[model samples]
Target: MQNFESLNLFAPLEKALRELNYQTPTPIQAKAIPPAIEGMDILGCASTGTGKTAAFAIPILDFLGNEKPRTRAYHPTVLILAPTRELVIQIADSFGDYGKHMKFRQTLVYGGIRQDSQVKSLKHGTDVLIATPGRLMDLMEQGKVKFDDIQIFVLDEADRMLDMGFLPALRKIVAKLPEDRQSMFFSATLSPTIRELAATFLFNPISVTVPSKALTADGVKQSVRYVQRDEKVNALHSYLSSDKVDRTIVFTRTKHGANNLVKKLERQGIVALAIHGNKSQGARQRALDAFRDNKIKTLVATDVAARGIDIEGVTHVVNFDMPVEPESYVHRVGRTGRAGAKGIAISYCTSAETKELKAIEKLIGFDLRVENPKFKFGESAPAAKGGKSASGKSQGSRRKNKSYKPHWQMKGRNKRRSKTASA
Candidate 1:
């Protein structure tokens, strides 16, 4: 119930919040801003659209505004690291929005384009530098950026960072930071691994956990449709063709799958864009911008590409392929139903993916409502008639198919090979 004014933030920050029409503080913001402004380290567990960005950004801006720290060339006072370029860009944008009234210079450092501009920005001096690990490491090696003067450090989407195998780079970067700096670690889930990771960066940090409802797939109308593997594209196309879908993001398991799905949708007269790791930074940003502006209503992306992206008014999130990890299911479904808005998450599940679906169900602590949609573009009936069971065998097959593996696991094994293919 606390408001931004009650947090007693700097006058400039309070003015900016009011101009942005931000009145009451979210749970994470309410709990994190007070101590964060007091120069306390924070360990926060919150998901996208929970006002997590403001939780850290507000405090950092307030501190910078009040102290009026000297901006050093190649040495930013505040460092914020995210897992992907999209996330890094979004974080920088959040800082821009929240720090509008403050007198501070901020720059972004990420890969996929060129370092000349980023290098120039660094040389010009910056107060807040937001970057991704890979490009930041490259810059660090070339002595383009330094962390010697860092006053505040934030690692947003800590879980995603670890998932993308950025631990070594994170360790190297953390080693360069000043021990006297205020560290804030934010993650979607504070698993044992995350807790262990936070222990290394944070010093006597105050832990803030958002209510469980915000972390889970709450406020979303979730449903599962049983369909054969071949029917997935048509089923998805049918859904997209409907008038109800507005600003939908389709999740595919692989980069190739995302591309293929986009092609299929385009052939079906649907204008959709695909984004994955293989896409360049510019391409990803263009697609994200198009989606945000409603220039494109449908966007197909892999889990890795879509993580930590906060786009409002997403009406639907279609799971063209179920995520291999149960935790990813929560992240995928969370794309919609954000900021107290009602959303629909439709997951298409084949018999081979039943195990994955069950894992997701177990993680979410409830069953997804089964939906049986009548076929329109297709030539036949629902998947239930003459369909394989969870065992991935025909109805007449009595013998156990011991060689069966979940679709997601099968995809996992070929990930190394798939890496070489374009998204």
Candidate 2:
């Protein structure tokens, strides 16, 4: 498929994709791109790491090529909206890489950094804009950025946009755009509200989903151990000590827990890193990069995939703690088994977390092979008398009705948008 080429695609894109080792088109890409290039509204439903970035990006880059800039004002010709600061940065970088052959001017906006700098980036009149809903809306409110001229508008990670609490801001921003324009929405999973929100923007969209995310990517081998609450760290130690896991990301429920886990690993003479909300922005980037570059062997984080991290070759995703929500399990383990590479997700559960474990199984629609670890393959989490069942009510569906507030609250403006969207 490396030899495969399309007339609409420019020379630079072909060469860049080859360099990155992207050969054949994934199902999501093969189906979504043609219609997108033809100016059709697209609703892409693929799980994380299905090359969704390039799916939307290749089309946008081709559409906006050689189009005059939006003058001195910050009204973008191509606006890519994402849910988190990490995603914002990643999309910007993707634009840069994909459009390297062309003179594509782009900028990114998110809340972690100073707003003044972002405003200045807009003043230069970028052609392509990637941003999170909050900072983008804030800039629009200040009259620093405009959307009247936006020709291509994309909402990447659509479900996540709702999860991050950006529905209100998304509606406000979309309301400001020209009613007739090419709009696209991409997400791992779409709910009723996401559908309602998409209807308000997308015109006759083509919706597509890669196979069931629950099927567990063919490359990944999953297993679980029902250890006592106090025994988890030791079990994880055993796994790490075996030399099987070259790189690892341990997911924990709380910010403090992630940090403590990293510290504990260090005390045991294993250097590691932790990334969560409380850490400074610089620290998070450093930790992620260090792990990716193999400077650090272990990295711990909270369950936010928006952390704009795409570290290739992640061998194992250890659920140091099982997620409270099953939908979250998709995003958590998703950090591994990326880009069609093989990976593993090992969840360490105690009787207390049995309900959470069962909830994940139900949502994924299949029972994960719960192994005793000590015995062999295809074993189940050990049964103790009256212990909670690993099969319980799915939690993914339960968290769907949430109202996510953007990380950055704009004082008076937030209340109105929040109320309307959540209501």
Candidate 3:
């Protein structure tokens, strides 16, 4: 469908769409909504930020609206499973936005917080239940939730579920879902393993595939800066110092790395926060709120922690650590350049990370331009092929300068660098 109006959604949904200024349907939405509204199972392949939330949410809302659900405690008519708490929350927000004019009760269930409120919310009756796998499993084991009344089952970020080792939990959850319910499976990639898993859940499903380019939005300008392992923090600080950067998310490979990076940035006088599995839900939420409100312009996060975060006005994404998984590179960069807005993705790579960089390049089908830092921090050394530095200095000169200390190490350097490090 060219527009949401052509989809023939419920009256309230159409009204909500108009108010939200959602005119044209995204590729996944255009292909998935019609069949979904017709009660057919959908197997959709699309990346984050492609409006897939609306693709499945709208049809589910339409179904709930058309057929007034018989509310029952612990029985949700729609069960949407996402890989992370942020994504579950994001999906719930989308549902609320799209179904604002329609009356529906939805509850979010996730771990890292007391379950008292979530349990009470479930007992009070809800039309939709959005949750992460681990918490949902706990609730199921405790007999606080049920799948008997589920009319629609949605498994979003299916590939991520596998990456996080949620297959066993997924199978158990799917077993509880009624066979009569309509199912929808969405993932960034439709690999053989994902397809095999989807076959078990969906019957003769309609497959909707968004083009591969959608995974890496066209508006993002991607580049890499080769820095020594010890100088990564300084290199990142320099980039954050640039006036071009606004709201940014810096991805790290480990939770400890994320925390350390935040501390380093703070030492540089750049107020930043870290989010990872180690953080309490309250802490993560607070960090996210600060970022969304621009109270803090930068957030350092691990790959899993930052998954499913859909925020606007993110002008740049920095990779503080190269991700071992190429798929994660796509996810990290996808955080920016959303909603047709321009974005920049910069990665810091050391000599040891060249293998990971090559893997990422092979996956993206292109090479990232090696950007020379304005103030070199020992990244000018020649690679295997050998080349001169950006300053026309010989490889030998670049080597001789490797021991050269930058402003970060000088007696009065940090104080001076702090002035230029404000992000």
Q: What is the lDDT of residue 115 in candidate 2?
A: 87
- With a 3 Å backbone cut-off (N, CA, C), the pairs that clash in candidate 2 are 165-404, 358-390
> Lowest-scoring 10 consecutive residues by lDDT in candidate 3?
414-423
Q: Which of the two, 1 or 3, has more lDDT?
A: 3
Give the local distance difference test score of model 3. 0.88
lDDT, candidate 3, 5-122, per-residue tens: 8877789988999999999888899899999999999999987888899999999999988898898999999999998888888898899899999999999999999999999999
Which candidate tops lDDT? 3
Write one digit per residue (lDDT tens) for candidate 1, span 332-359.
Answer: 9889988778899999986567778888
Candidate 1 residue pairs that clash: none
TM-score of predicted model 3?
Answer: 0.87
Predictions: Cα RMSD each? 6.7, 11.3, 8.3
lDDT of 2 by residue, 310-380 (tens): 77888988998888778778777777887678898888876556677888899877777877646432233
> Candidate 3 vs. truth: CA RMSD?
8.3
Give all TM-scores, in the order shown: 0.87, 0.82, 0.87
How accurate locally is residue 337 in candidate 2, as Cα lDDT from 0 to 100? 81
Q: Give candidate 1 misplaced runs (Cα > 4 Å).
A: 215-218, 373-423
